[model samples]
Target: MAKVGGVVAAGFLGLSGLIWFVNLPYPMIRRPVAGIAPMLLLPSYLSMDRNYREAIAHVEQADQLVNQATSAADIGLGAEKVKLAQENLDQLPVWFLGYEPVRMCHFMGCSWNFTFDEFSRARAQVGRMNARIFQENNALTQLQTAETDLQKAKQAYQTATNVSQQQNAIADWQTALDQLTVLPRETLAGTTGATKYRNYERDFNRVVGSVAGSNQTQTMIAAAQQFAALATQNSQKSAYTVTEWQQIETLWSNAIDRLQKVDSTDPDYLAAQSYLADYTQKLGVVKTRLETEEKSTLAIAEAKRQTQELISSLPSKPNPDERNRLISRLQGIIDQLKQVQPNTTVYAEAQTLLKQAQSKLSQL
Candidate 1:
């Protein structure tokens, strides 16, 4: 009885040892299939044989990985590499998520050629490409530096709560990040630049947008009208210096440029168009007035020069009729100059000319 029991125990122990030995390489065998995963290249599946939640979840996971791959491709990882990686990752058994591996063991099955060794080689190929990006694109380093600058600016903005300081900090952050464009190549920078600019633009516009708000249309209209009013008033009075007139025109021009940028999608697009037309019309009137003022000034100058010549060539003996004509011409020039508003530079010239002409006439 003891000998039979000993033999049975030895058989049981040997079987257990054999089982452990067989399973020892299981972990190693499972790696490549799991590692390359949905990212590994596989034939397109007509149906993954998964329930709705599980299927959708797998797709979402694949999408995220593919998007990252696309970003990686921009830095020189070929698109095909990313596509193959995604294919490997998107399969079952390896990424079964829930269903039994045996159930999915159709077509190419899980453990056949899709083992850890192949996955490792594929992953290594991809990993090598990803690591190569930092080497090939020197701008990748510059991009990182710009990002650090943006972070610093953000910190400064946070520390300074004042609106002005915040605006400055935001502007600095944007400028620093914009420097990335010159450094980073388009392959990598295109997507990143767009994303970074979009984010910074949003932050930059926070104060601006809040201030503009729903009343953008109303505010634009009011500002335009006010600018028109000021310009028209100055032009009508002819009371502006050349420099002053130029400044007014510049202000109006800047306003128009801003109005043109009003988004077509804005609710007030039609209103903006109407206001733009009206402002343009007003600007035309102002331009016309400026031309008229300039022509009038030339006429006055001509009249003054002719009168001065006439006065200098006057007869020493009385030529009452000719003297009367010269005085009358000078008087006309003075009147023309005075007709412009008190603010007109021509008005001051007019006063001086009038005094001289009057004194001359009295002496004659």
Candidate 2:
């Protein structure tokens, strides 16, 4: 029983020693492992030192090839180097030493090629955007300038027309005055005769003599007629003479009222006021006509606003016709851009966009 007990005790001690040995922390030689499971393969790798040195040499050669390919400007030559280096990496043993740099070089070369192409595409897009903005800005400027010039020209044309009308009115007044002067005083005073008829004739002669040409001669003629009519009524010594006097006073009041609205500082305003005053004296009609003509006045204002809007919408830098043509071309380019496919190499789409933009600019 004692010998059996001794054998059992030794067996238990041997089992504990085997377990401790299997779980021991051991350092790896080439492919280092943190735990015991991989430590058993350490010796085999250490014994393959000759194969390991050859793998290191291949890795170093691949590194040199990657550097050469990166520096080369010739696309074909650089691509060839990258291919060669990749072939070397593929041929290397799975467990070769210094394997990571070889793998990294392969991926980096592929990635560098992709990034270069992408950058080129992005830069091309930026150029296209700049060009489009420039064309639109230039066109807008031209349209605005042209519109302003047109407005000034229209104003000048109207002013010239008004001046011509005033001259014509003055000529008509001179003709009226000549006819009145030849008429007998009794013929002008039909209903009643006045000794003051000669005084009205004298006043007309005085105004006609002071005239700086015949510009306001028509107005003076009308005023003379009103004065002569009043004299005829006064010959009867009737109250109707007061009414004729009031009518002549009202005509003068309307002329002065319109003249007061004119801004003397503005050249055009001065011309307009002068024209209004001349018409008032010649016709004595606007006081009754102005209220009825308000609608036409509003229409003119609306027309002016519409003209301004038309000019605003027109391109500024280019002529209107040219801008319309450019806009159509720009639309075509935008359609082309949409149809263009994203490229894997150079900026093919961006290049096409740039070409279209340049073509449109040439047309402009």
Candidate with maximal lDDT: 1
Q: Tell me, by TM-score, which candidate is best.
A: 1
RMSD of each: 28.6, 38.7
Q: Per-prediction TM-score, please?
A: 0.33, 0.16
Angstrom error at residue 238, model 2? 97
Instruction: State the TM-score for model 1.
Output: 0.33
Worst 10 residues of 1 by lDDT: 38-47
Predicted candidate 1 versus true structure: per-residue lDDT over 1-364, tens digit per residue: 9999999999989967654443332335333443444322132121333322343343344334433445544444343444445454444334333322333355446443244564455456555554544443555566667778877887887797798886677666655655654553334544566577667656645744643333445555666667666766666554666566676676677557657856787777787788778777766765655665566566557757767777687677757787787667666755655554444467577667768767765765
Off by over 4 Å in 1: 1-238, 318-364
Report the error of model 2 at residue 363, Å: 52
Q: What does candidate 2's lDDT look like per residue over 67-150, in tens digits?
A: 332222322343343344344333333443342223433543321212334334433433443343343334334433433443
Give each model's whole-structure lDDT: 0.56, 0.41
Which lDDT value does model 2 have at 234? 36
